[model samples]
Target: MLRYQWEDAVRFWNSKKGEDSERVGISSRQKQKFTHTAGSRSFASVAEAEEVKSGQKVGRLQLFEITHRKKDGSPMTSEAGEIMEKLKDKKAEYEATASTDSSVNLENIDNRIITEVLGPERYSRVRFQGSGVTLTQYFGSGSQQYMPSGSQAKAEVQRLRDQMAQMQANTVE
Candidate 1:
């Protein structure tokens, strides 16, 4: 999968042998292929990209990107708490408007892994979001209910999906 700002947008294709080889180290050939594939994408120019394993439990390296809107800002901090806070209110109208005018538009897309893959339990405990960004855009609110991984998880994810879709739809051209 190729993720841009946490959105799963593109599909990555690689040979099984290539995938296996990357477990040890990426070959020059593989590197070239990755560069070519990533470079050809629409988000290639502005989005910072990295190779992420499928899940915390999985090891298949996949592409994930984070678009930087402000060139003046320093690289994102690596601290987990800071990352969560940075991502806390990125969707605010003022922030979004400021970002859209920049050379690189900053967009934090809907990420289903927070529910479908990680489930609510793991999602609540995890502090990080997206890949390659120095800071994350979303914080874990922590679980309120006893078992967030149950139907509650699905509901939360669905709600977020709807919210994100509405936000996207309302974006000013």
Candidate 2:
């Protein structure tokens, strides 16, 4: 029965191999035939041609065209011109307001807001001086200390215990 099953499997594999050989497969060159035409041209030149055909501008020219022209591609009307002037004035006003708000001196900011944001302990330590504050003043000047690990830590603990024991003994005497 096992020999019959092995023979059947071998026949199935031979049939599949024969079917694959009979079928036609596309070559890599045929698959990329269309891409070869476009790829022959520089990408930028092709893109520029497409943009010009579509009535679109490139980069800063596009931005200028958009701002200057009406949405329907007609020249700006008198009413539209007035609206654009109003928008420009509003924009200038908004920028002036923003500049004034941002230019406020740090010293002019209320202590209450600073205290609330920083919390009491941090606020006390970080009280801003006009000359400029150093990070060391706010968070200690000490560098991070290395801690012993494993056997070293155990030895250190034992040494500390021995010193404490000696001190206790002396106090008792």
Candidate 3:
């Protein structure tokens, strides 16, 4: 995994590079901080977290901080509940639409789901949105694909659900 400085990420996103790169730096709005604490979530190891400091200009999605901690205090699972529901719906939809005439390859299935389920901004994380993917890779093709097993998938779904529940809990308070 590569360590990206928040300011550098901002510069990359803002398209201001090298000497031409504005010294003024990226605005906080354009950068997001990923931290860990109660009622918080982070998708990074302790070392990774240490590498990044708060108030640093991380990129749009370069850093993920879970707003809610698990029982063990880890990332809040990068999974999305709505996406899982949609995945179920998609599987059903595929079965329903499955036909002798219908020819759907893995790539086709993945692309369709990615396009429909995730809009432009959210679509970047193509792994969860797609049918099968190497979970390890961040939307990249690899030999050792990281497709989640049944238990792993279940855990992720549960984490997403718990996060939502926590958000709801916070909103109520």
Most accurate candidate by TM-score: 3
Collision count for each candidate, in order: 2, 0, 12
Report lDDT (Cα) of residue 14, candidate 1. 57
lDDT of 3: 0.43
Question: Clashing residue pairs in candidate 2, if any?
Answer: none
Question: Which ranges of candidate 1 are over 4 A from the true structure?
Answer: 1-109, 113-136, 141-149, 153-173
User: Clashes in model 1: which pairs?
Assistant: 76-134, 87-137
Off by over 4 Å in 3: 1-79, 103-106, 121-173
The better-scoring model by TM-score among 1 and 3 is 3
For candidate 3, the per-residue lDDT at 55 reads 45
TM-score of 1: 0.19
What would the per-residue lDDT of candidate 2 be over residues 50-126, giving only the tens digit for each residue?
56888774432232233445556653555434433544554454355336554322321223223333333332333
lDDT of 3 by residue, 25-134 (tens): 44542353322243222333432443465645432122222222355645443343345456557656655544422332233344444445544324234422222323
The root-mean-square deviation over C-alpha atoms between each candidate and the true structure, in angstroms, is: 18.1, 29.1, 16.6
Worst 10-residue stretch by lDDT in candidate 3? 59-68
Candidate number with the higher lDDT (1 or 2): 2
Could you give me the TM-score of model 3 versus the true structure?
Answer: 0.27
